[model samples]
Target: MRCLVRERNKTRIGVTALATLAVVASGTAVVTAPEAAASFPRGEWNETAYRGQVEVIPAKDDRSDRRVLRGKVFVDRDRDSVSDPGERGLRGVMVSNGRDVVTTDARGYYELPAYDNMTVFVTQPAGYQVPVDEYNIAQFYYHHLPQGSPELRYGGIAPTGPLPEAVNFPLVESRATHTKDQNCVIAGDLQTYDKTEVEYARKGAINDLAQRHDYTGCGVLFVGDIVGDDLSLYPDVKDLTKSLNGPVRFLPGNHDLDYDARTPEHSFDTFRAQLAPAYYSYDVGRVHVVALNTVRYPCTPDVDNPDGKRPGCDDPENKPTYNGRLDERQLEWLRKDLAKVPRNKLVVIASHIGLVNYADEGSPVHQVDQVREVYDLLKGRKAVAVSGHSHSIENMKTGDLAKGWSDLFGLKGLPFPHITAGAISGDWYSGQMTEDGYPIAVGRDGGRPGVVTLEIEGNRFRERYTVTGQSDRFQTQLGLNTPTYRDWYEARQEWNANPEGPAPELGDPHVVSRDDLAGTTWLTTNFWMGSTGSRVKVSIDGGPARWATRTQQMRGEDQNVGPEWSDPHAVAQQLVHGGSVADRSMHLWRFALPEDLAVGTHRAEVTAIDSYGRRFTDALTFEVVEQR
Candidate 1:
């Protein structure tokens, strides 16, 4: 991935309208508009109605000379990318060269020092909009890799020898961006390793995206792992984006790296060329999104240290190593980027490796190395982070804590929301294939393959998860966790991998005896997106509802793992079919059974209320039989 650079100057310069027609170079395209008087007269500034022309001049003789990339942030009145005669420029619009951010002048012109591997993009300012391609993918940036990338397995950017004189960005008036309320889809890993998995993604989440139109302005942000390790599947990824109903943005995951590249500089050359910048920021409504590149590959040991111990790849030239980290350059850019954003606006930070996770709870390698630094940067702001490397769904609220985080980083509690959006390619496309031709890749935490949506109202936000091939009402999975179920869980693990007989069954989900209740019997509910503010209540046999306690309290306690904490509903499917073991989670809740209950059939009504106060109800039946 490309590094974020510093801006040379914030002062904007005015370019005189060309009296003569400039010849465009071969393989170059020029877009121009009739010169109009500057909307904002000298000494007076209007945020809107600023006007300018977009001119493309031929390259000069010096191939090595780095030129300044000058462009106009014009208002595309007709919604066409080309700046027409009636269209005007937008002043104070932020533009960046993958690093430094500069505002458009009164005339709407912006210039930044250009480099070989920079991507110059205009941040979608509030009340303004950028053009979307045929696939509803935002087309706001211009990649400036004049000579393209070095030779690789999957082709990187093709050669574009000289820089164009004008790299204009067009925007139209948009009320959707100014509205207080908005819906933004945040999807996690679409780790499709091959063509079949690509189809799974298409039928699964991509199909879901096509059916939804609510998220128009903020759109969908796939938080990394767009494809599996195979970079050649990028075309298929592009094809999948076409199914989306709104603008689609992406971040890069460890699997998306170009493994063949020797240096970290070119690790994501193909990704940058085909998808988006390694790191960037944008705005919609009162929310500012800061997409970060947190994966550092070929992580070598510090040879200078006295400790002889080393981790990851010792010789990266032969085999690759990956870790969750942000280079110093990205951190600097983040500081500068946040400086421009208002403190009151809600900041949604997106990254591939999460700041913290339950999946890789104790492993420091799977979590971001600079968690404290990032938190310190956004100290007082209303911020939330969304990430997707671990393939599990998690919604950690403010003040929540995990034992791993405390033990590794000395962090006592979370200061803001940190959600790990569940993977789209659930459990790496494992398990039995569904009727829809996709695998029922239930995650390790019992979270079904799905996407997370953030419903934002000004500076406050509420998050919800939508499981693939299911309705919004499908929020929780209910199961009976008893001694019998625990025995079945163990037996299935021992025999299911290589079965000598019929697979071990989980018996009847609704039948339990006094002996079963005498042991460890309880009602378990896996609230897929449950967080601190959420609650789960159970009402047995039309009695008063009693709140079910969350198994893992994010109060600095160690994670409660193993079969006792596993979601029996997930275990049933995973053990019988095939997939990752659902051994632990941060969202599972349980209520103990009443030992004094009379012998009879019992009906339990479960109600789960999310952090947003939205309620979902499900029912389960079990028999409390008399001892033989």
Candidate 2:
């Protein structure tokens, strides 16, 4: 798959009514680097008004050169960035030496001689828009590095010595022009393990994109995990992009990696060659999009380290074992990238690894290192950082930015928002099958597999999550704890029990019986559970339920940690009272029916289950009508 580079768009120099911006073998026209010129005229800038140009005049003594090449670029009048049939190439479109100018050929292409350190940029015409990154930074057409740029201590384009002569620029004709006008789509991890799963994604996402035209105008940005470490699937992903109505951009994830990346520099060589800037900035409308590379490849192998080592970088074993962090260079580049952006413009920092304090706060593996520094960088700006890789949904509205980093660094609440965009693959390789016979990667948090859309007006943006092939109705929050749920859970537990001898008889998977409904309480009975130390609850007829203390400790099959004496999942072994059911999988929850109920046909349902082990109810039943 071809990794496309969508760059940051900065303010383009505005060229005036100059008919020709040409520089010949010099007589006396001053020739210096372009950046030495004044700021682009603010009021003169427009989407349709093409500006900025450079003259390729040779040195005074060297008059032997006769070849003069020149061309002009504008928002493709026909809207195709590439030149096409019947579309007139804009002529007389001025390019300059920051003073004098030149125009285009019949083909609408422009050129200038190779010059040293010249900042050659296109003049944005009136009523046309430029592109930007999530950080609201504009993209420069080309760095024009003839000798190549310097190596950035942090990260940036290497310094190329000079701009080459055949300097032609491309522009997609955009009409509705405003610094504030832009649209963007955010896609989380598209982790597919095999070709079948790739086809599954094709059936799900590709089918959805084929029908979407709204996003065609802006383009799509895919947050990492493009492939499940199996880089071979990238071409298939590229095939999927053809279905997209707009340009496709990508940021790398742990899965999209060079397994041989022993050091940080080699981390994304494969990805860089495929995608654009690994951690770079681009602009669209008033927003600056900063895509970051957060998966840090350890230079030192931990193969013999105390903790268990992982297999291939794509393997599931490798994920949790490795910590996610932005290397020192990326962090530095971020600081500089942000410094260039105006504070008023909205900045969207996109990364594969989210900041610390995700699902497992204490676990450094899930969080980003130096996150506090990252958060601190956006102190006063209107900014939001979005990431995916956790494969779950969490919109943490925390004023406390350093809640996860305070101990390590003296950091505090962040001034902006950090949103963890839910993964497109949902629970990685888990989920049921869809009608198309593809495994449905339904999100564990009840969110539908989809993309996020940002509507920008001025510097303000409203973010909306769009589910693939479905309407907003599919966006939901699951509620638990009705009497029906209690019975279903009990039955579900019994049904899913691992076969020690034999499995239970087949019955209605959704039904809740009176016996199971009695003492109607269901526990989450596992280790990953127990928020704030809350446990099981039992209740009947929507009344208050009492908590059930763990008597016996049960452990997961994979559990081999410290002494099982304190493991909550291990402690829940008491409820495994009878029968040879699987230990860790069986979560026993119980609730008793109300005492005052004059039994006829009473109904119960588990409507909701909270993090605190609290369960809500929605239940009803028909009594004998009192025989009046």
Candidate 3:
């Protein structure tokens, strides 16, 4: 960001009303506004000495009856840590104690029911910027743990003696963040298991992000599984944040849980201590993004999994498991949070486990158990749900249906767009090594590693996923599926085992025989984010374009699975290189050519149209021969 973000703005409310608070206001030290759009020489946070922390004022009176946590959300006018004269409190900013949410009053003062080990945080309101540390981590919350976390591995939060008298949150008014146009990045699953995978992420996705300057306005929200099971690597994850030029927020996934904890209440304490609140919401532009901790760890059948799908929870010998369910407190908190958001604003519900997933559509444990309730809550609102865990990219629009959704969720069609943002560490960063020091790590459904961006102007949005190491123009992967290829596909069904004889050679993917044309040969296009309303058109040798048929109709049918429906292009790589096969994608489209076409070279001009009416064109050349 070239321009300064700390410039003062004209006031709306009079100064007389600011008398209640002493010190006030803050804005970005350096941020690129849409008006003054530009990039920084370095791909790093716009950090400066203006970095600030939350103010924790010690208590004066000690009656030992502090049931409610009280604080003020003030604009740190001087960017000082303390609230002084002329600095006014910001009103209507929501604050939460990790559960119950409350908004600040006209005076920017708020009181919420607090408990032990709770984190009191202010949801950084739109048009305002929160103070960030040198590491660019947002400093908006105060952890209140009187006794600290119990002794365990990775050393949890240290002890704090008592709750503060007032925990004032300091924010700066940033025109950089105040704009109606926003390109909010909704990235999912950078689940690096160790240092190697961490390095891969740095070189792959993080490096790709550094070259772009689009997200400084609204910033980036990593939807969960920030790392694998190792809590110790949080610092390494922070190092990756250095490459970004935007404010970053995180949501916890199942792998982020503290498995050492004996109970569910403490499952994510380590994550909260190291990263962010287990669940929270913030506003940017006209969108209210709700980041949810959907993975419930140490799930018990009695409370967390009442539906009985998690039968292992009842077994004495079984290790405590995780399930896709929201605790009562979070559910209640979501209700309150959504109530405050106006009907006109777009509500983006971001989570780790998707509300509904195409990859794990039949598994009860993979999707949220309270999907119906979530849908009910989102009624009469323009909303979208984006999640990560599945590792596949799916763009399911409203009115799209699946049999598993009908059978398990009792959902015939989606209430809103439910997109499964493809992972940064695609398939756990597994596959043949790349020259740039990473893996191809193609996703299970053939989608490559990528990040999803929601470009919004006011309340509405257009979504797109950019493949890592590739430009945004690259969207679809084209391939050929023939009768002979299917035979080789079935022979290589054992994904890990090597064939006894020489593997069948698909000599030239472009070459086709009369037998191939006669026996249901198809031209496959893997449009990663394609969905019900998306279209794929093919024109043979520059002839008039014809629409291609989508493999999985998504009209209340089970998975249109196996080799025939698989992305043969991705399958060839996965079978030989590594990772899950590209069988049964929600976005695969196919077109069959006429069997009697004259034997000659042919060119297929492909055009893919997304639901938002964005058009992308690609082409492939092939040949029709008398014999193979």
**Runs of candidate 2 exceeding 4 Å displacement:** 1-169, 176-183, 299-322, 400-414, 444-447, 477-498, 504-628
Clashes of 1: 1
Model 2, C-alpha of 373: deviation from truth (Å): 1.3
Q: For candidate 1, write residues 1-628 as lDDT tens digits.
A: 1111111231222233221223222222222211222211222111222222222333444466856888788886654344445568889888888667888999788999888877778788987666654334566676677677778677666665677656677777877777888898999999999999999999998898778878877889988899888998987887887656566788899989988777667788788766777888888999998889988776655521113222664667776677788877678778878888889999999999999987887877799878999999999999999999999999999999888898877898898999999999989999888899899898999989999999999989989899999999999999899888898899889896678988778777668878888996889999989989899999999999999999988898887888899998888888877788899999999999887777888889999998878999999987877653
Task: Assess the local accuracy of residue 159 in candidate 3 as a C-alpha lDDT between 0 and 100.
Answer: 64
Candidate 1's TM-score: 0.88
Clashes of 2: 100
TM-score of 2: 0.58
For each candidate in the order shown, give its overall lDDT on alpha carbons. 0.78, 0.48, 0.80
Instruction: Write the candidate numbers in order of decreasing lDDT.
Output: 3, 1, 2
Backbone clashes, each candidate: 1, 100, 13
Highest lDDT against the true fold, candidate: 3
> Cα RMSD (Å) between model 1 and the true structure?
7.2
Off by over 4 Å in 3: 1-50, 60-65, 495-505
> What TM-score would you give candidate 3 relative to the actual structure?
0.91
Q: Which candidate is the best by TM-score?
A: 3
